[model samples]
Target: MHETVTVAHDDAAVVKMADLFDPEPATWGLRGDPYVWAALRKHLSGKDIPASLNEVLALLHAAFDELVGLDLVTEPASSVYREQYAHGGMSGGMIDLDAWRQRLIPLLTERARMRLEA
Candidate 1:
C-alpha cells in the first residue's frame, strides 16, 4: 500500500523493483507483503494515492537508470562495488532497506550525495 511515498527519490523503489526481474513478482515487505500491505492500507486509511502505478513505475525506472549509470548514486547490491557488499541473494533480509541504510550511510559520503543530487 505505502501510498504516502516516504522517500522522494525513485532509486529506492527501483532497487525494490529490480528484485522483480525475469518474471518474478518480487516481495517488498509492505509493498508486496500481505501483512505490511494491510498495515500500510490502514496507515493510509481512507486517503487517496496521489500517484498511479505507471507513475511509480516510471519514477522507479528513472531512478534505477540514474543509479545504474553512476549519475553518482549507488545501489544496495552495488553494481559498482563488491567489497562493501553483503553476500546473499535478493530474498535475504540483507537487502532490507533499513539494514542497507544502516550499513550504507557510514560508507556513503555527503560529497557523493551532493554529486548525485546535482
Candidate 2:
C-alpha cells in the first residue's frame, strides 16, 4: 500500500494571481506578503473547491494575516474605515502591532534591498 498526499496551487492559479500583482506590466512578478503564496498554496491543497464563494473567502481570510497589522486600508474622500478592524495578525489578545511593524519594516527593507542587488 502507498500513502497518499496532495499538491496545490496549480500553475494557472499562481500565474493568474501573479499577473494581477506583477511589478511590471509586461513581465511577471508578485507584490505583497510572501505568505500570500503560502496561503494560496495551502488553500488549494489539491482538493476540489467547496460549493460556495463565501467558503473560499473565509479560507483566504484565515490563511493570510494582515499586511501592516492594522487597518492599513485607505479610502479617498473618507477619513474613516467603514469596516471594523480585526487582527488578522493577532491570535491571542491586544498587543502593539504597530510597534512590531516599526521594528520589522527596516529589517525587511534591508533584506529586500540586498535581494534586489543580488
Candidate 3:
C-alpha cells in the first residue's frame, strides 16, 4: 500500500521544514550526512520563513554554493561512493552524492519553493 502525506501551506509548515535541523535525535539523521546538513543550515535560517519565492530560491542557491565551498561533497568522495554502489554496496541510492547536492537538490527545492509561493 502507498501512503499519502500532506502539508498545509502556511508559515507553520515552512517553519517545520526549517526545524529539521533542531539537533534532536529524531531529526539528527541528516546531521551526519554532511552535504545535506550543511545545505539545510545554509538555506534555512532564523525562526520565520521568507515572504517570497525568489528569496527562497536565492537561499537554496546560496546553500548549494556553500556546500560546494565547504568541500563536504567532494568529487573524489563521490567517485568512491559511485564505485561502491556499482559494486552492490548501499551508497544511499545515488551514484554521486555530491552531484545530488550540487545539482538536483537546488532544482527540487526551488520547485517546492515555487509551489509554496503559489
Model 2: residues with Cα > 4 Å off, grouped in runs = 1-35, 66-118
lDDT ranking from best candidate downward = 3, 2, 1
**Per-prediction TM-score, please?**
0.21, 0.27, 0.36
Q: What is the C-alpha lDDT profile of model 1 across 1-118, one tens digit per residue? A: 6677565666433222222221222343212122222332333333322234444334433442433232223454422322222234443222233322343222222222332344
- List model 3 lDDT by residue over 1-118, tens digit each: 9999996777645553354344422222221244454446645666354566566555555664454443433334552232212323244413344545565455445555654666
Off by over 4 Å in 3: 1-34, 37-47, 70-118
TM-score order, best first, reads 3, 2, 1
Worst 10 residues of 2 by lDDT: 73-82
With a 3 Å backbone cut-off (N, CA, C), the pairs that clash in candidate 2 are: none
Clashes of 1: 0
Error of 1 at 66 (Å): 0.2
TM-score of 2: 0.27
lDDT of 2 by residue, 22-89 (tens): 23223112223333333344444554333344443443334333522333222122111212223244
How far does residue 1 in candidate 2 sit from its true spot (Å)? 27
Q: Count clashing residue pairs per candidate.
A: 0, 0, 0
